[model samples]
Target: MPGESELATLLRDLKPMLAEEEHGFVTIPIGSGWPQGLVPVATFAETEGASVIALSSILDGIGLEYEEGWAKITIGATSALSAVGLTAKIAAALAETGISANIVAAYHHDHVFVPWARRDEAMAVLENLSKVQE
Candidate 1:
């Protein structure tokens, strides 16, 4: 299947789906062993630490204190890695309402992380954005 590249198509077809599992971003030192079954959706290397996404249960199971309570919004658009403005458009819409977005762009889909408490509102905003094309 072909991936979407146009900004308009990406926006109109975003079809954001909120994941049922609550997630969090946590940091561990570079040399720390990765816990079993703790599959990070993404990781980043920083000068001070290594960032990862671990399910809340995994964190608790491993006895690791984590920055907790973020929700995932998987934008259901097969957007090209080079697609532009999709992130900006979504971010801007959420920002206008004082919501914050942390985005993870993968090969097949873009996942957005929003404050756990605001997941419902974020879903509403994204749903409206998609309907704009209808």
Candidate 2:
């Protein structure tokens, strides 16, 4: 609601909560049509030719099929919408360090999905950014 600058400031003010969400992940081929049943577990990669949805499995019927090598770090805040460029900025930061991030911007927060091995480092970088940024 605020804005990118405001969101950054807010994130800076709040105590960083570094937690991990790791579990099943699957990439399904529903073509141009979405699957009608089964629940997705953690993350899903749905596609119709080139159009794709690397979406969340929070409350869907899609079942998760894999169980290794994925992690999520939630940058919790609704205002994160304002932090658009900032997300890419942080992403670039992670990228420079070779940590791939798959960002999911939910209604209430922005979730960054990273490789399981680099999750801790990713969290540290983000948390540190929140702290040092004024």
Q: Which residues of candidate 1, in runs, are more than 4 Å off? A: none
For 1-134, candidate 1 gives per-residue lDDT tens digits of 55899988888888999999888888878777776667776888898688988677777777777785899999998998888889888999999989999988888998899999999999999999988966
Q: What is the TM-score of each candidate against the true structure?
A: 0.92, 0.64
Candidate number with greatest TM-score? 1
Q: What C-alpha lDDT, on a 0 to 100 scale, does residue 77 get in candidate 2?
A: 46
Per-residue C-alpha lDDT of model 2 across residues 18-108, encoded as one tens digit per residue: 5544533455555535456534433444353322233334313364344355576777545445454656766877888898877766655
- For each candidate, what is the lDDT? 0.87, 0.58
